[model samples]
Target: MNDFERQLQELFNEVKSMIMMGNKNDAIDLLQANYEAVNEQINAGNKGIEEVAILDIIALGYMYIGDLKFVQSLLDMMSGIVDSLKDDEPLLDAILLHMGSMYSTLENYEKSMLVYQRVINVLESRYGKTSILLVTSLLGMAKVLGSIGRAKKAVEIYHRVITILELNRGTESADLVLPLFSLGSLFIKEGKAVDAESVFSRILKIYTKVYGENDGRVGMAMCSLAHAKCANGNAEEAVELYKKALRVIKDSNYMSLDDSIMENMRIDLAELLHIVGRGQEGRELLEECLLITEKYKGKEHPSFVTHLLNLAASYSRSKNFVEAERLLRICLDIMTKTVGPDDQSISFPMLHLGVTLYHLNRDKEAEKLVLEALYIREIAFGKDSLPVGEALDCLVSIQTRLGEDDTKLLELLKRVLRIQEREFGSESEEVMLTLKKVVSYLDKLGRKEEKFPLQKRLSNLRMKYKQKVQY
Candidate 1:
């Protein structure tokens, strides 16, 4: 190798070793030093592929440290060089791949998708269809598409990638795993839980065949399957699958599994348990998960706030409103400081705290918090979203308990009904519940004329629900 190449390789090794040793700051410093040295070399007329390679290494290090600004700077520099080296297809392709990944990391999905598509077009035009080089760009494009809420398009691209991999590397090859996983996750996001379950089951079988039952990948697939089952409303079965997945993970070597992954699995299991009326068990598991997350990730980390939210949910499920309120406040404080008060994430804790306050007979405080949450939800998810419906439901309950006038409550109920009907259909249990509430308020206000029609609608819904249950 040339001197510059050798030096870059040595620097890469050093940075990798430091990162593996858990000395991330040391790694960053080493990378930064080498990056400046490469810049000096480039300024001294030593610029070439070696300089680009060094920049790539530095960009990767910055990415590891979540230093997106530095990463973006490096990406821009690389893009300029790649533009000058348009004839060098391999180098240009490599730079575009990194640029796409960096844009994705920064949540610039549009730019990421464009870069990936350019890479794919270049690779396909040069090497023809079904080239292995297209896999990376295709996968990147699929992920960006999914991130930008184009799940169907993402799924199509993912399937295309899977087909190419299966044709080139065989069905059971590990190369198919990632595309399959992405496809399954997209299915889940699209609310196609049955499809997700099928995909995950296939993945579980593949992992089991390749790495045995106790492999961490197998455990992860099991967890994915469990989530699909839970989404499908098979909570009891999901609970069993989660337990099995946890056992597999725990039985594996500690080095093979990430602590954060285990923590997330525990959280999922706890959530399912809570859904199945095992609130105490779920609460204890969440408490354990919270302590571990705080110890490892620190209290200010976003994951720590997520654990706190999950634990608060457990507390609320167990009727410990005081504890739930305290935990929600902590989460709200952390999110407000870290993500700002106006972030959509804060709305969840606000809504939860509002519910807890309502249960505690603090109607005024509950109303204020719920209104704030509703405003945030409306801004973030629009007026017809399920989250807006939920926030409105909480607000209506608080208003009803506060003895608000029927007119205001009626308006709120109608809004809730419209949202629920749009989301879940008129025959849904949610619509039935809202209809009953609307009827009750109408009757109480002595509006018998309006109450009769709502009562008739409620009766029809009850019949539909009964017939559905019977069949």
Candidate 2:
């Protein structure tokens, strides 16, 4: 080999050795050095394949960092590679898949989606339309899009994934459980509780036959079943499922399985307990979990703030207003520091603090804080959105208690009702929420007429949904 070729081979061998050693920091350093060397070589008109390999190494290292900026750089580097790559090139499909993974990490739903489209295109042209790679890419992309809030695209991709997973699994295979869980999760997010319940039940039957009732997979299935149960207003059933999941997680820890898996499971169990009226128990679990989280994530970390908020909610539910208010204030201050005052996370603590103060009979302070929250929501979601309606209800509730029944209170009520009807249909939970508020508004305003209509509507709804099963 020529002298230039010999040096380039040496550089590649050094990077390969670093990567094989599994020292991620050392590998990254070597990759950076290779990148600088490649840039110099490119500047001197060397269009050799080693430059592409160096670019690949650099982009892959950035992928390991996982923060959004690094993921962005990784995706940008992939786009550069894609533009330069030819169809049917060796490693081209693999590079595209890595690019898709980077976009997925960055939460770039649009780009992740487009790269999957390109993946399918390439797979169809080269490997035929029915290649397994197509299905794999679709499922992977669906997970990313779902995580990033693109539910429609996720549903579409999930449908294709279901078809492929089923085809590959045949009718009676246990592998169908995987996609069933994925689609069930999406169905839960979409409020299709019946559909999610069906999928979860099917998966539970198969998984139980294979792994029994107390396996970790079974624990997750139980947790998912709890979500479905909660959606159906079977809070009692949901609570039982949460307990079962918790027992399984505890068992797994006792058996020396992965603690990280059990940790998140325990958190979910605590969260479910809080959701189901076992607030004291939930608070205890959350407090213990918070100690671990605080050690790892610190007090101001968003996840720590999340656990604190849940504990605060439990305190509020148990009527421990002093502790609730204090915890909430701390969370609000932390959120304000990290996400700023205008961020939506600030509203979690803000609303809870307002609620606690209102319960403590500090009406004037509650009204002022709630009014600020309403103003922020109005700015964010427009005056007629569902969130605006929620703020209006909280505001109207305080205003009524404070006896501030001016024309503005009526205007806010009307706005809330409008949003409730526009967003949630007449018989839905949100409509019921607004109706309950309207009844309260009328009661405080001495409007027997308004109260009668809302009462009648609620009675009719109860009758219409009379067949709805509880637990």
Candidate 1 local lDDT, 345-395, one digit each (tens): 899999989999999999999999999999999999998899999999999
Query: Roughly what TM-score does model 2 have, to 2 decimal places?
Result: 0.59
- The prediction achieving the highest lDDT against the true structure is 1
The TM-scores, one per candidate, come to 0.63, 0.59
Local distance difference test scores for all models: 0.85, 0.74
Worst 10 residues of 1 by lDDT: 82-91
User: How many collisions between residues are there in candidate 1?
Assistant: 0
In model 2, the number of clashes is 0
